[model samples]
Target: MLARTLGALLCAGLLVGAAQARDYRYSDAHLHYVDFFQETEGMPALLEAMDKAGIEQSMISGIPVAKKWHEDEPKRPRYYAGDDADAYWYSATDSYVAAAVEKLPPEQRKRFHPFLSGINPVDKNAVAHIERMLELHPGLWQGIGEVFTRHDDLTALTSGDTPRANNEAMTRIYHLAAERDLPVLLHSNITSKRERNPLYLAEIEEPLRNHPHTRFIWAHAGSSMEIHRHQEKMDFLLPTLTRLLEDYPNLYVDLSWSVLQPYLLDDKGTPRKAWLALVERFPERFMLGSDVVGRFSSLGEQFQGFAPFLDALPEDIAHKVARDNFLAVLPKPR
Candidate 1:
């Protein structure tokens, strides 16, 4: 009798453990294959991480700029903002992404959607780089960007003319994206620190108006970690996004780490009703992303953190945001 009871308890524990495991599927809409230093943990490690995290598909790209290791510094910096060292546009980063994906087995290759992101957006000649990459890679690249425009301190730290979403260079890029039927992931922050309003609204709005044919995944829905760290919350963000989604059919939002705190989930990690309503109103327009750079260990946690928000959403919408929405935005394969 004692042995039978112990066996039953052991089986119950196993059942509970299996039930608690992460079974929710995910398609990571925003992941960097390399860090700011232009380094990666290799493809094998990445694949392992993805398998562990239950990421069936991922949108992978390289960081547009490489942080410079200043000669004066005694030790190497772990991140871009580690010291006063400047970062510069490194087009070769794209090649790294291309090479990494190409070497994978056919089954593994299909799981990754590569995006071109190493060109400096401020340069008018940037489009040439895009053209060259497309020609070189053929159908390997499915999208463009995580394009750095008006990023907070990174803009100040990068060495180049500040990129604007509506700038002439980006205008040309937008036209090309439309021609290629490629969706563009744009990281044009809605506001900088110290300003309370959506100060840079026109920058992104102009392109959305002009390039209706091209799909634009607005990274973080125009928020960033820096902006959140400083401002805590943007009171205007939810309403602004609502208006934009209502206005622009081509626009989509990447709900990565930046928007998770204070917006989607409150301080207590509960889903906000206002955000839930906004997502329910435009269920097709929002997607999930890990936004993990070069490392994938935290992929599960980054995505699972949204469980509360996803649970609050309708089951169909939750699945869409977690996986299908991102796949919908990618250009149809040739």
Candidate 2:
């Protein structure tokens, strides 16, 4: 009897392992190829992480701003938020991404979709900079952002005028994205940490309304790690997204890990029904991302964490959210 009980437990453990194994592939919809310090683990590390994570493809871009190593600081800060040092727009970041991907063999190179993001979103000349990048590497850039606008603490730390999604500079950038057939992944927060309502909603909404032709992937569905840290939840996010989806056809959402907890999944990590319904209503508009900046160790866990939520979704919709949606948003050949 004891032997039979042990055998039953072994079979149950095997079944659990099989259940936990991921069967679907993933296309990381948002990833920073370089960190605020303008560094990465290199392509070998990234490819290895992706291979382990089951990420077949990725949308790779550089952080537009570089954190300054303030002179007064005794120790160099490891991350952007480590100190009050100002970060400035660094155009060389795009080149870093290009260099890394270009060095890869053709097969490996094809796995990455590089986006140009090394521009100050508040600078009107930013669009011109993007144009130059496209000309420099004819068929290289696949999309436009992870453009930092209205980001949490980064807004305060970034040098120069604050960037808004509806600003003239970003407006011009949006037009360029539409013209070039490149989807723009914008990181415009919906609200500040203190406020509950979508206070900054208009910033993104204006662009969505005005630039109907440009595909805009609202990174983290307008939520940020900083904001999530401060507030329990943005109670208004779901309805706001539903309304936005109903109104704008070109809008897409990146389900990065920041959005997974307390919104899509509850405290116990169970998928929330309202959020599931929202995805079900607009299956083609959602995609998953690791949102890992310059580090790859957490890539597998970042994606695998979504398994509970993805499993709750319908099979077809789950597949689209996991991989197909991101590919669908990529720029088409001319």
The Cα local distance difference test for each model comes to 0.93, 0.93
In terms of TM-score, which candidate is strongest?
2
Q: After superposition, how far is residue 16 of candidate 1 from its true place, in Å?
A: 12
Query: How close to the true structure is residue 305 of candidate 2, measured as C-alpha lDDT?
Result: 92
* Superposition TM-score, candidate 2 onto the true structure: 0.95
Cα lDDT tens digits, model 1, 220-320, are 99998888778899999999999999999999999999899979998899999999999999999999999999987899889889989998888888989
Expressed as tens digits, the lDDT of each residue in 37-142 for candidate 2 is 9999988899999999999999999999999999999989999899999989999999999999999999999999999999998899999999999999999999
TM-score quality measure for candidate 1? 0.93
lDDT agreement of model 1 with the native? 0.93
